[model samples]
Target: MYRKIFIDDENAAHRELSIYRKGHVNAIRLNDEGYFVYQSLPISAHNYAALFHYNSIDALNALPFISETKNGLDSWDEAYLPNTLLEKLIGILGDELDAHRETKPEEIMLGWQDSPEKISYWRVISPTEFCSFLESLMAFVKEAQTTGYDLEFIL
Candidate 1:
């Protein structure tokens, strides 16, 4: 579901647009020598901001998303592609999807637009929609695994 919110920040009145942050989860198929071969349409992390803790550094660091490293660097810190990550991702997405299915919780995205921005914007992710996203992500991960490809989360 789409939601709109009013903000009182006077600084953004005349600005055209200012998107602070963006994230994308994509499944990539690479050739030998690590050359890019293919990439799936990204599943944006914009709606799932809570999962990444938004701007709360402490809470964000605690997430497993930062623990999974590729070549000794945080996986989420860079576009590090680790082939084994999808298996873990499936379990996480599966559990989250199931939770939404069972409890039917309503989640809203809290972003800069919700505070003070030129545009009045926000999102109310309904249970069904969130579940759909989880399902799509799970399916995407499964397909990537089956194809022997790796996933990359660009945040």
Candidate 2:
């Protein structure tokens, strides 16, 4: 399972991008014309949020679904963060960003995956790559605020 980040403008235009992941494998499908079609990128929104110091994955996952008009609802197009929340997030992320810059990827383990056979796999993202992503996320949030778009998390 994965989560995709997208920006929808006032005109309902959507620009989607894949979240960064370790050892990513593209999942493709075939259309009627035998043309290969790829869906949105598969990256866990919880994991992505964890990278930003939002370690309440269980809490986030347990949030109740709201109507489409309500902001911060899961599986809805209304995940916009209000100005106050955005400001708080920015403040929190600023410190995290600086810390990430000084930390190396090898020094941090994002998480692990366990298979049925008891195999364990650890995933990590390079500091440079994570910094780039953090920069992009900050830019996206700012742009969303300026353009009246919502910062949505599709889990």
Candidate 3:
């Protein structure tokens, strides 16, 4: 129902990792035979990236929301945010995130999934607001990296 994003240290051995759903253990095993396994941080770590993109913008925007039919993939539960968007987000949200960490207080997280009363606002966000929100997410990733985190998208 929901996807998770993870951040960890960069591993030169395994520069890229394959993404799969929780139930696709068998598929992962089959695919793993072809590549060398690289050790990663334990999943229990509080390193899970909290990035989220609402379904509305995902459906209309040209972002990297993976499509099973369009991309000839087998699962609908996995996707990745493209690197370009990721970098842009990091640049936009860096300062805000740093301030949040220093303050340790409740923050207003914006997204296209705002409450029904604010539905009109989210609907009009489309490309701009959504992009800003994504930048915040990328900022989270950048912050995590400074503390020894790498990134992963678990859908």
Candidate 4:
């Protein structure tokens, strides 16, 4: 069984995104000090942005749309891969695919944490949780999956 954790306060939520995508499979890890951001122009007028805080390259691969490209690695960090590897990865992430039309909200504040710092600063955050946090949520997901309710989303 997967572990389940709660993000009940400010500190936990702040570290949620970065920790969730730490080490996945084929995703890239760009260094932004305190953040992970990915953007694309999908034939649309405005570019979409997905930001987070990740731990390892494998965790990054679990991101949405990263597996439907031409080389699979276009979304991966080119700086970290060889020329041949980059080409192969791009093909995997950007293949012949239509743009996604799902209109889920950008920010989802699942819950909060118990911090003595402030009055639980209310703010929106990514849908998934960090490593420490996801262990708990994953359990909920497993249960939900049995009920035919899927709650997967991309930043």
Candidate 5:
């Protein structure tokens, strides 16, 4: 079971993404169609805070919910990721994926994310799994773009 976040518009995915505190096994359901699976790494380092740059991740993390994930409260935090930012993220993540293909997962690391810390799952993530995560995110972003809606994380 999980708590949910809300939105003001109609086109947004309201209660799609699942957030599990025990692990990072997350999935997003686009508009009631189906589930998009993105598996987890060894440890739940940052728990997706390692996906974006400073401003974006910080904005998401700054939301009240992220701070209380461990409390198991009925609290909520905003998860509105705008399409404009996702546009840039797509290219950056794509480049990292390509680099990983050319080099090794350990070599490239999570070079896409800004300021990856020692607490991150950088050491345990595989190239295939990382690419899978990127692919799922790209699909979600593309769906949001097609619908002319900003991506909303149902955290």
Candidate 6:
């Protein structure tokens, strides 16, 4: 699945470009739609706390209805398995394996961060739609290698 994090609105590309001018974070165009995509080594360390740094419960609740899949529920705590895209995504990603096994009996906070100065977010997407989105995104990237793009999640 394509993984991503949301930081904030960048009003001017040139202004935001300065953040990466020093090469601390590698920059890649998400697609061709002009949305910035910052490439970082996929989060694996940091003790799983990074996952909670970018997810927002309010944002999640505002998303569209996502069909619950058996696979998505298998990895989530029973309390979280009722119905929701988060549960579905967890079920799909954790299939045959524990997605949040350590957090049993409780819901896991999948990466998000909040602050008065700035807001940042991260999300784990289901592999099921990863390929299709990649293909579509590839087509966009091929069209405009220099332009950035945004990948919107449809649940």
RMSD in order of candidates = 7.2, 13.5, 14.4, 16.3, 14.8, 18.1
Model 4 CA deviation exceeding 4 Å by range = 1-79, 95-103, 110-112, 117-155
Question: Residue 82 of candidate 3: its Cα lDDT?
Answer: 37
Off by over 4 Å in 1: 1-22, 29-37, 44-46, 53-81, 103-121
Instruction: For candidate 5, give the lDDT of residue 37.
Output: 39
Off by over 4 Å in 5: 1-79, 103-123, 153-155
lDDT per residue for candidate 1 within 1-155, as digits (tens), equals 23455322243542233422335566665345765645554434343443443222222233344323432222234454456666766776766766566544444434443333343444444566556767877787788888888766665
Q: Give the per-residue lDDT digits (tens) of candidate 2, residues 6-101.
A: 222222222122322312112222123553323222334333534534333223333332335554433323232443355555555566577667
Of the two candidates 1 and 2, the one with more favorable lDDT, higher being better, is: 1
lDDT of 3 at 155: 33
Q: What is the C-alpha lDDT profile of model 4 across 5-33, one tens digit per residue?
A: 43333455544543222222212233335
Question: Can you give the lDDT of residue 28 in candidate 3?
Answer: 17
Looking at model 1, residue 13 earns an lDDT score of 45
| Highest-lDDT candidate | 1
User: Residue by residue across 1-155, what tens digits does model 5's lDDT show?
Assistant: 12222221232342122321112322232343544433322213232422332123333343332222442112133233344555665665466556544434332123221233322112233456555665666665566556555443433
Ranking by TM-score: 1, 2, 5, 3, 4, 6
Q: Write the per-residue lDDT of candidate 3 for residues 108-130, one digit (tens) a residue.
A: 22222233333211111123333
Provide the lowest-lDDT 10-residue window in model 4: 40-49
Q: After superposition, how far is residue 88 of candidate 3 from its true place, in Å?
A: 0.9
Q: How close is candidate 5 to the true structure, as a TM-score?
A: 0.38
Q: Give the higher-lDDT candidate: 2 or 5.
A: 2
- Candidate 4 local lDDT, residue 104: 33
Q: How many clashes in candidate 5?
A: 0
lDDT of each: 0.51, 0.41, 0.31, 0.29, 0.38, 0.29
TM-score of each: 0.57, 0.47, 0.27, 0.25, 0.38, 0.19
